[model samples]
Target: MIFLLLSIICSVTVGVLLKLAKRYQINVMQAVTWNYLFAIGLSLFFFKPDFSSVSFSLISPVYIALGILLPIIFLFQGFAVRQAGLAKTDIAQRLSLLISLCAAYFIFNENFDRLKYVGIIFGFVAIVLTMYKKQTSSNNKYSWLYLLLVFAGFGVIDILFKLVSQLNEIPYTTALFVIFCISFVLSLAYILYLAIAKKTKIQLINFVCGCILGLFNFGNILFYLKAHRAMAENPSTVFAAMNIGVIIIGSLIGILVFKERLSKWNYTGLVFALIAIVLITLSKLHAV
Candidate 1:
């Protein structure tokens, strides 16, 4: 429970930092690139994942793909924070569980329980309501397209992580390390592309901000995994708490600290999200 709370805090902090980056007109791409660099180092120092047993043929493809995908989605997340603000972005990210739920039922051959079906229905409604933005004139209206991209990209990422986890021959930590390494290289490629095009130069401020991001980002995953292990008897609890906690805390931060205004419809959508999550957890009650 403690681990889960810490994980939620770290998750919200990542978004907050990205949101704050807007004040300095921080180069989000550069910050994300440095985020990967530092993330790889932290993974090495803390996890020390051994690569000796890695079967490249079986594991390499997935890790390489994740390497590309993670950084890309992270860039989307940065854009969403700046474009959509923290509240909607966080809800969209959490709503990705609905996609994963569908994948699990269709591709993974999981039983489609009644509660989860209702949860799925509620999830769709939640997406529409949470993304509702009243007419505005700041020319800063939330980009629903970007928010949807965040939703789909994260859902795909989660499904891929499930695949990697099922491959018991490869150590989970080792696979994570390889993915981080690949993400680092991919991000660096993007940075170099910018430099060659005379688009922008790397700045120290990016790294300064990125280092803070790296610590909390890594902490989020670390604490989440720990929470799962700690609550192995109730894996569904971890899943529900992690998603719902992020929503509740993230919304509070956005509303209270950032002073982002959410419409009544958006508030209604958050209520629906909670109900959807509860239904999903109820569905898993018997399975675990």
Candidate 2:
């Protein structure tokens, strides 16, 4: 539980820092690359895992493909955040939980009660509402296409996590290392493209941003792994608490600290999202 909370804090902090990085014109792709590099290194320190333990014979190509998609998602996420702003982008991304839930239901046969249904409904409403854009002289309206893509991309990523978790007896540390390797390779390719195109230069700011991002990125996975481990001990409470708590905390920081704005429709959407969250919480408590 402690780890999960720390992970949530780190996750929110990443969003804040990413937003700040825009001012430095940091190379988000390179930062993402370095983040994976650091994550791989960190996993090694914790797991001291042997390469022999990695059973290539048992691994699925589809599962490995999913791992590769993570960095691509990060690439899209950077654009989404830049274009849509923090609050809207995050709301869209979080709504991808619907995709994960459906995948869990069918693939993992995860069962839920009536309250979960209500929660899903509210979550859907929140997604729509949060995407509502108000025309302002100062700010460009949120792009619906960008929001949709962000949601879909992250939705698939979330489902991939569940799929990978179920596929092998791989330690979480090992799993992360594999994911980092895949993402790092892809990110390197992306950086090379940028360099060749002369779109931007990788400078000290990019490296510094990457270093900071790496710490949070590594912590995010570690804490998320801890959350899952904790869920094994107390499923309903831990899962519900972690998800809703992170969203609430992230949303609060986005709005108050960052002064991210939403239109009237967004407020309504947030209400629904909150209601959905409440339903999930209630369901968990009932199970307890």
Candidate 3:
């Protein structure tokens, strides 16, 4: 429970940090590209994943896919947060939880009862609430498109991680470490391209921002891995907690810290989203 809570907190703070980074004039791709470089170091030190046990034939393809997907997802998320702000962006991203759950059910043969079904419906409601727009202007009109891309990218990333975990036949820690290594190599390639193209100046502060993002990201994933392992028997419940908790906490922080505001209708939608979260928690507790 404690690990689950901690993971949620870290996940929520990540958004706040990334949004703050934008205020520092950091471009999305540059910030995320450097983030992966630093993430490689932390993943190595903490997980220390050994490739010796992995069957190359089975894990190689998944690793490659993960390598490609990660940077794309991170880039999309950074753009989404930049355009939509953290509150709505996070709400959109949280929809991936439902996508992942559905994939796990049909593809992985996970089971859920009637109450869980109710929770899933609530989650869908939250998604609708998230996609709702409070104000529409020329600039912000297309914001939903960006957020949707973030949702799609995040869903694909989640499914890829699950597939990699299954194929590698290793703990989530090692699988994450492998993914990070591959992603690091890819990010380095991107950094080199940026350097050659002179797209933007890579300042020390940019690298430092990436390092900070990497550290928090490592902690977020680490706590999540621990929570998942500890609650392996109730993985769905943990997912439920983490997803809704991240949205609520993250949204609150965006409002309080960043002064994000929603319309009256969107505020009502936020209430529904909160109710959905309660339903999810109640369903999980009852299942237990």
What's the lDDT for residue 15 in model 3?
Answer: 81
* lDDT by residue for model 3 (1-288), tens: 999998888787778777877687876566676777787788778777776765555456777888888888777777767677888888777777667768878988877777667767876776676767755677777777888888878887888877776663666667677677778788878777887897656677777877887877878888888998898998868877887788788788878888987766556656666666667567667767
Model 2: per-residue Cα lDDT over 122-179, one tens digit each: 8988887887776664344546667788889988887777666666667645665777
Best by lDDT: 1
lDDT for model 2 comes to 0.74
Per-residue error at 122 for model 2, in Å? 1.3
Backbone clash pairs for candidate 1 read: none
Ranking by lDDT: 1, 3, 2
What TM-score against the true fold does each predicted structure earn?
0.96, 0.89, 0.88
Model 1, position 154: C-alpha lDDT score: 94
Highest TM-score scorer: 1
Instruction: Give candidate 2 regions above 4 Å deviation.
Output: 136-142, 284-288
TM-score of 2: 0.89
